[model samples]
Target: MPRASLWFIRTGLLALAAGFTLGALLLLNKGLPIYPGLWRLLPAHIELLLVGWTLNLALGVAYWILPRFIRGAPRGPGWPVWAAYGLLNVGVILACVEPWVASGPWLASVGRALEALAAGFFAVHAWPRVKPHGV
Candidate 1:
């Protein structure tokens, strides 16, 4: 596995842990009513699990498994995927904080936009790697 893939996967695992922790707290709150403020974590929980964990892990696996060029760089340039990784984490953080701020909607929107852009960057990195049979 490439270093970038390792980083992506590790970050994803961290997000998964955090998401599960929040989810457990939410569930406990539902049963015990420890604090009503725990309800505000719902959006963050969803964002962390969905985008942070799922997307990051998927991207890392994709990066590792995707085909390589027959010539030149094996995995193509590394910068785009690195950018994707950075943008994705930043976006997830921004999105997860959305519910706690007055400008939440806008922040969430920007976060989503950044996520989409990160996808585009990853796509750019992965596009040429996808090929039929033995090219």
Candidate 2:
């Protein structure tokens, strides 16, 4: 597997762990009343599992398997994909912590915007590779 692919998969797993942890904490709080209103973190947990984990894993696999632009370049332009990775992780980080911060709403909005931009980058990078191969 490629380094990028590994990074994506590992990061996704980490996100999965984080999501589960948050869920467990929520459950614990419900049973013991440790943290009041921990329910607010629900959206963060969902985002971590869905966008941070699932989406990144899918994108990483696509990057690994998709047809390249030329024989010399299997993954096409490297920067855009790297940018997508960075953007996604950063956005997820910001989003996950948003609920606990004072500037949460604004930060969450920015995080969402970043995630959207990351998706756009992935789409643009993957567009040409979507067709069937002649071989």
Candidate 3:
């Protein structure tokens, strides 16, 4: 597997952990009323688990398993992958913390924008790899 794939998988795992932790805290808050504003984190939890964990892991696996170019290369140039990685991680971080920060709305907007751009880059990088089998 490529180093980029490994990084994506590992970071996805981290996102899973964070999502679970946040979920647990939310559940505890429901029963114990410990955290007054816990509901505000619901969006972050969903984003972490779905986008950060699931989507990221899927992308990583796709990057690893997808067919290569005619030259037997695993994928295209590395810069876009790296950019995706950076944008995804940074976006998720910013988005996750947005709920608690004073500049939350701004952060969330920027984060979402970054994530969208990252997805575009990922699609662009991976699209060429999709091909009919036994070509």
Candidate 4:
């Protein structure tokens, strides 16, 4: 497999780990009374899995696959790819503080939206017909 394919799998595994960790934490919180409210952990766990894991995996696949576009020059990683990665991580990080801060949900939502926009950027780079086989 290619190096980027490995990145995709690693990202997916990280996402799964985050999800499992969330479930375990929830159970622990309930049984051990680790915190006041278990619901407070929801956003952080969700974003870790969804944005950090899922989004990162998707972007990794895109890095390997999207270069078929741009016709003449191959699409290389630099500004656009880095921006996507940064936006996704930023969303996840913001989610961690979202529960305690009260105003965190709104901020997390904006981060999520920005991450989605970054995905759109990848799609644009992967524009149809750029591939020789037209996949």
Candidate 5:
């Protein structure tokens, strides 16, 4: 509906596509004997799909859905919306790409931190939703 909502929905859909595509790749890795380190690739694939796809999608949808949970408009959606979107997407991308390209422990760690920060934003932003829903 809104730009923020669109961001969330797009991110959710991207995450889904990532999961399915990456899952298939992972399966292909295991299936193809020519693919070296296929076994090792499996773990990264799983993490990418799980966190990158599933968790991110869930977060985005939550972000999109959160407006309804709060009173009024929610301070215009909070500053963390951008941070969450940027950090989560960047982190997941780095987490997925860096491991394959070059030394990425730092990138991965930063990515992890970013993702955590995104989660923190979600927690803070969605705090109002935590209360008894039926009340």
Candidate 6:
């Protein structure tokens, strides 16, 4: 596996752990009412699990499994994928905190835009590699 893939997978696992922890807390709160504030974590939990975990894992696998060029860098330029990784994580964090901050709506919008940009970056990196076999 590529180093970038490893990083992406590891980050996704961390997000999964955090998301599951939050989910457990939410579930517990439902039965025991430990703290009503736990409810606010719902958005964060969803974002972490869906975008953070799922998207990261998917991207990591896609990056690893995508076809490579016969010459030069096997994966093409690494910066865009790295940028995707960074932007994605930051976006997920911003989106997750959308419900907790005073500037939530704006932050969430920015986060979503960043996430979209990350996807565009990843697409740029991946597009060339996605060709017929033995091209």
Clashes of each: 0, 0, 0, 0, 0, 0
RMSD of each: 0.9, 1.7, 1.5, 3.6, 3.0, 0.9
Q: Candidate 1, 22: how far from true, in Å? A: 0.5
Q: Which candidate number maximizes TM-score? A: 1
Clashing pairs in 1: none
- For all candidates in order, the CA lDDT equals 0.95, 0.86, 0.87, 0.66, 0.68, 0.95
Q: What is the C-alpha lDDT profile of model 4 across 13-66, one tens digit per residue? A: 776787679878987887888776876777777777766777777767766665
Better of 3 and 5 by TM-score: 3
- TM-score ranking of the models: 1, 6, 3, 2, 5, 4
Question: In candidate 5, how many clashes are counted?
Answer: 0
lDDT, candidate 2, equals 0.86
Model 6 misplacement above 4 A: none
**Model 5 spans > 4 angstroms off:** 37-40, 67-76, 132-135
Model 3 residue 81 CA deviation (Å) reads 1.1
lDDT for each residue of candidate 3 in 1-135, tens digit (9 for 90 to 100): 999999999999999999999899989999989868889888889889988999789888988888877665557787788888899888888888887889998999999999988998888888888986443
Give residue 80's lDDT in candidate 5 (0 to 100).
Answer: 72
Q: Choose 1 or 4, whichever is better by lDDT.
A: 1
Q: Give lDDT for model 4.
A: 0.66
* Model 6 score (lDDT): 0.95
Q: lDDT by residue for model 1 over 11-111, one digit each (tens)?
A: 99999999999999999999999999999999999999999999999999999998877788789999999999999999999999998999999999999
Q: TM-scores of all models?
A: 0.96, 0.90, 0.91, 0.69, 0.76, 0.96
| Model 6 residue-pair collision total | 0
Measure candidate 6: CA RMSD: 0.9
Q: Report how far off residue 71 is in candidate 5 (Å).
A: 5.8
